[model samples]
Target: MMMKELHYSGSFTVNKPPSDVVNFITDLPRAIICIPNIINYEVLSKDKARVRFRVDLGNEVPIAELRRVTTDAHIELVSASGNEIRYKVDGRAAGSTISISLVIKVEGVNNGSRINWDATANLGRLLQMIGRFVNIDSLVKSISEDTIKGFIGCLSK
Candidate 1:
């Protein structure tokens, strides 16, 4: 299948220090739970995991086959230092291959930390076909952004 790349970035503040944020994120078992729609996850090691999640296509996609799908991804921490962390995820979704690279940076602020994150998603032909009918770009971005927001929100609590 063919691949198309999509990029997204966002920043948010949490009521915690940079160290706390880094620690929480680096703890694979704890941090993975914050991912949205995550059905199950297994920590393979300190920096790797197997994750299964479901995507909700909402009412936009007219095709029932593409409306809701479950995908499994292998997540690995590529690097982490100070307040920055990077990860790579590879999976298959809707009969297509998906790969994602994510980077997160944290900065200490007054009484909390500001987390900035960006991700690149390489999607396969199935999504390209789906895009022809709906705004797949927006849907992907919304889901990506929500995942990050949810992660930070959960960590803050």
Candidate 2:
């Protein structure tokens, strides 16, 4: 099996202070509930959780079963201090391994706050098989962007 990597980085602003943003992010139970497509989740501790979610692979994977897969991940909040939060994730879906590192930085801006985030995902096995025929990276990227946007939108409210 081979591995492929995908990277994502973006920023958004909301009408909230940096401390408020940091508090919300560090409060995993409150913050994680905002994530979209979550089938179920369990808070393992103060900074760790197990989440199950469904992924819509769309029409890119050829087979229907492969088009929509359920994935489970273990997420750990590695660090949260000041205006920054970091997480490490490991998961499996469709018989493949997935590893991710994510970071979020908050900055005060004009009475509000700006959230800057970056993530790198390493996908194994499943992506290699699907990549031979479809642009899996783009498909995954699109899904990831949508999920992130939805999460941020939830926080904004």
Candidate 3:
């Protein structure tokens, strides 16, 4: 089996405190709604979430169901620095397993807080096969970027 991993990093300046941006992104239900392909998401339990969605890749539409396991949908600071929030998400969809580790860092700047996001994903073999043909990485990247933008827009309003 071929193991494929993807890493994405981006930053945005929000006209709010770090706490506000952190709170916004940590809301699982609300955050998932920002995702383009997500139909809906439900909190199955304290540490679990289920999502129903369809990924549109040009002519292909892959309907998917994902379950995420996490301590909470809120950011947790790991150290006294208070600059980073760490989290992990594990799920399954599209006949494949998905695991993501994310770290969001916030820094107070002159204008606002500079929100830095880094995410890494491990794609199972089956999903990698599809990715090879359909440029899944770029597609996913676009979706994620758009989602972040949407969230920022909502925060601004």
Candidate 4:
């Protein structure tokens, strides 16, 4: 079976210093709250966490019928440098092992900062079949954009 890869990259400007932008994002406790539909997160260690997410099934699926599919991913903070933070996420979502590597870079722009981010996900055959209907690209882009916005918004004050 061939594994399918989904990729996304984008840049956004934040109204904060690079240090503050990077610090706020790398801080999970302060960052998770900005996410939508994040059921909860369990910090296994300073570098590892298992995050639960709630996916809306919409009205088609009845209340008792698979309303929420939780993907428990073991996320690890791989590295944090002056310009970037790298992370890895491994977990099973929809019965397929999904692995993702993400890198976020923050550089000083004017008085604020410019964030360059990219993420790649390896989805197994199962997810590829389901991926057709999942709109993974849109989902990823939306999440990434919101994450940056959320981080910057929360820290600007």
The digit string of per-residue lDDT tens for model 4 on 1-157 reads 7788889888888678898888887886666667567778888777788887765533443334443556767888889988899989898866778898999898999989998888998976655664455565666667667766766678777
lDDT of 2 by residue, 19-112 (tens): 9888888888887787778999999998999999888877856887888888899989999877889989899989988898999999999999
Clashes of 3: 0
Taking all chains together, the TM-score of candidate 1 against the true structure is 0.95
- Model 3's lDDT to the true fold? 0.65
Candidate 4 C-alpha RMSD relative to the actual structure? 2.8
RMSD of each: 1.3, 1.5, 5.4, 2.8
TM-score of candidate 4 versus the correct structure, residues matched by position? 0.83
How well does candidate 1 match the true structure, expressed as C-alpha RMSD? 1.3
TM agreement with the true structure for every prediction: 0.95, 0.92, 0.75, 0.83
For model 1, residues 17-114, the per-residue Cα lDDT tens digits are 88999999888888899999999999999999999999988778889988998999999999998888999999999998889999999999999999
lDDT of each: 0.89, 0.84, 0.65, 0.75
Local lDDT at 123 for model 1? 86
Clashing pairs in model 2, backbone N/Cα/C closer than 3 A: none
Number of backbone-clashing residue pairs for each candidate, in the order shown: 0, 0, 0, 0
User: Measured by TM-score, how close is model 2 to the native structure?
Assistant: 0.92
Lowest summed lDDT across 10 adjacent residues in model 1 is found at 1-10
